[model samples]
Target: MADPSNYTYPSPLEGYEGLEPLPDEKETEGPNAKAFINPPSKTLSKAYNQFADPITNDTRGGFDIHIYYLQTNASELKFAAELHERIRREFPELRIYRLFEGPVGPHPIAMFEVNVFTPQQFGAFVAWLVINRGPLSVLVHPNTGDDVRDHSQRATWMGQPIPLQIGFLKEMLKRKEQEGQTNGS
Candidate 1:
């Protein structure tokens, strides 16, 4: 079994036959470095903007808006619970989970998860949060099957980005992969 702590997966850029490796980090220095290369412009098509989430698909992508607060702080905990209730009442159609007192799943702090199914719902939720969220950190991430990227790279934070227990998620994925391999073998 691979040591989870020290294990490093192959780079995402690997396997390309003709692509040459970039210069060493030390070599890419100062003003005219390769690192200074201008990135390509991002252009989204009209159809892409209008694309609706698949309602029938079990893999329906949605945001997990986590409201973080210190469990030890009594006032904060009370406020969090109240806020959770408010959100639930305000957004009746959306799925609002119960407020968790401590770390649950990959989350490292006491938080509550709100599931927003459609883009309009997500927008409305965010708009409400902008004015309503007080003394609490919000970690908003989309569920897109790519767990690592969804939790880290693609996440949006209303306040500070609370460090999630991503290693736990990675380990789970690894175990699942190992199981698949063993079953196949």
Candidate 2:
């Protein structure tokens, strides 16, 4: 993870909070504020960013995941509970899954975003999704402020993660067998 200290303060988020999005038509600015096209609004803004995520890709090639969730009218806690149950029953391989229901009011759209380790994991997730799927993929925006990623943090644990469970003796024995075979010449 890149050090939060390394970043310039008042992240790109600060300006966004009060920003009212322009209409899909051509942007017209106020007499003082100039209008510019938000490229993300125009083009599908799909650049990989690694400064804040797992995997060692230089933003573009890094292992990244974002999943979008939308609810018409929901109790976040209840939704999270139901989401957890679905994971446990449907996709057990996804050992740790998380859901975040953001603060309500003003911003009316309920932003439910989930992040996981790998694409394989997410694919499995989609397969097991019993309830909701939306057109949007989860996106990780640049972090600003105190900078702990509370919204997208992990939430559910289906089971123990799969790991290569080789004993020390097994590893040593395998190595010795390889050595002995090599020396037969």
lDDT of 2 by residue, 2-63 (tens): 34454455555753687676655545666634555554655432332122333332323222
Each prediction's Cα RMSD?
9.3, 15.8
RMSD of 1: 9.3
Candidate 2 residue pairs in backbone clash: 48-59, 57-62, 66-138, 67-138, 97-156, 98-155
The regions of model 1 sitting more than 4 angstroms off are 1-61, 177-185
lDDT of each: 0.75, 0.39
> TM-score: which candidate is best?
1
Assess the local accuracy of residue 81 in candidate 1 as a C-alpha lDDT between 0 and 100: 93
Local distance difference test, candidate 1? 0.75
- Writing each residue's lDDT as its tens digit, candidate 1 over 37-99 gives 543447743333332331212335377788999899998899899999899888988888888
